[model samples]
Target: MFSLYVFHLTPIQTKNPYPTKELDFYSILWSVLFVKLLIYFLAFITY
Candidate 1:
């Protein structure tokens, strides 16, 4: 079961063949959202 999961994830883990500007914008947006979530979680922990 674990090997099967790894096999499925392998292709998704590969780098993009041709990343465009749109991809970069989306990635930046995703990173911002991730940071926001992390901060929220940390605040919740401290409060």
Candidate 2:
């Protein structure tokens, strides 16, 4: 599921022509944290 979500973002990220490396790095970091929280939420719901 996590891989699928990241895979989905790949095209969108590439499509953005702006080459702000730092901003992209930060956004990716935030996305990883968001994914972790989402996974935790889903696990809690399942439990």
Candidate 3:
């Protein structure tokens, strides 16, 4: 299961052939995480 997960994740984490799309996927993933963290921080401050 873990290996399967890593296999699915490898394209985004590594740049072997399809770099552009994978990089875009990574950027979108990071952006979502950043937005979630920002929202959590703001909520904590307000609370």
Candidate 4:
């Protein structure tokens, strides 16, 4: 799932990279947190 997130962002990150490295780093962090939250939500719903 983590690899999937990285794979999904690669193209968009390459094509329209963030203006600042700090913002880019934050975006990646946020995306990872979001993905983890989403996974937990889905698992909770199903379990």
Candidate 5:
């Protein structure tokens, strides 16, 4: 399950592939964290 989520995020990470643009990298990191947190929240509720 976690592996699948990481797999899905790999493409988005690869798209940027560099930290030359700080804002873009931070935004992407935030988005990924948000998504992972959301997923965990949903799973916790369901469980």
Candidate 6:
């Protein structure tokens, strides 16, 4: 999970190649939120 978070934070070359610092940050944020929601869903089900 940590690796996945790091992976999303890493920069990648897009087709347009228009570099932007915010892209990586947003990706990491989305990844974290996704994991958090998944965990919450699982806990809800178990409870």
Instruction: Note the residue pairs that clash in candidate 4.
Output: none
Candidates ranked by TM-score: 3, 1, 4, 6, 5, 2
Q: Please report how far candidate 2 places residue 21 from its true position, in Å.
A: 1.1
Candidate 3 error regions (>4 Å): 1-18
The backbone clash count of each candidate, in order, is 0, 0, 0, 0, 0, 0
The order by descending lDDT is 2, 4, 5, 3, 6, 1
In candidate 4, stretches whose alpha carbon ends up further than 4 angstroms from where it belongs are 1-19
Candidate with better lDDT, 4 vs 5: 4
For model 4 the local lDDT of residue 31 reads 95
Report how far off residue 44 is in candidate 4 (Å): 0.3
Q: TM per model?
A: 0.60, 0.56, 0.61, 0.59, 0.57, 0.58
Give candidate 5 misplaced runs (Cα > 4 Å): 1-20
lDDT of 2 by residue, 2-45 (tens): 67667756765777755679558756876888789898989999
Cα misplacement distance, residue 36 of candidate 5 (Å): 0.3
Question: How many backbone clashes can be found in candidate 3?
Answer: 0
lDDT of 1 by residue, 1-47 (tens): 33554464445446554356755665566567666877887899999
Predict model 4's lDDT versus the native.
0.74
lDDT winner between 4 and 6, please give it. Answer: 4
Q: Which residue pairs collide, candidate 1? A: none
Ten contiguous residues minimizing lDDT sum, candidate 2:
9-18
Off-target runs (Cα >4 Å) in candidate 2 are 1-19
lDDT comparing candidate 5 with the true structure? 0.72
Among these predictions, the greatest TM-score belongs to 3
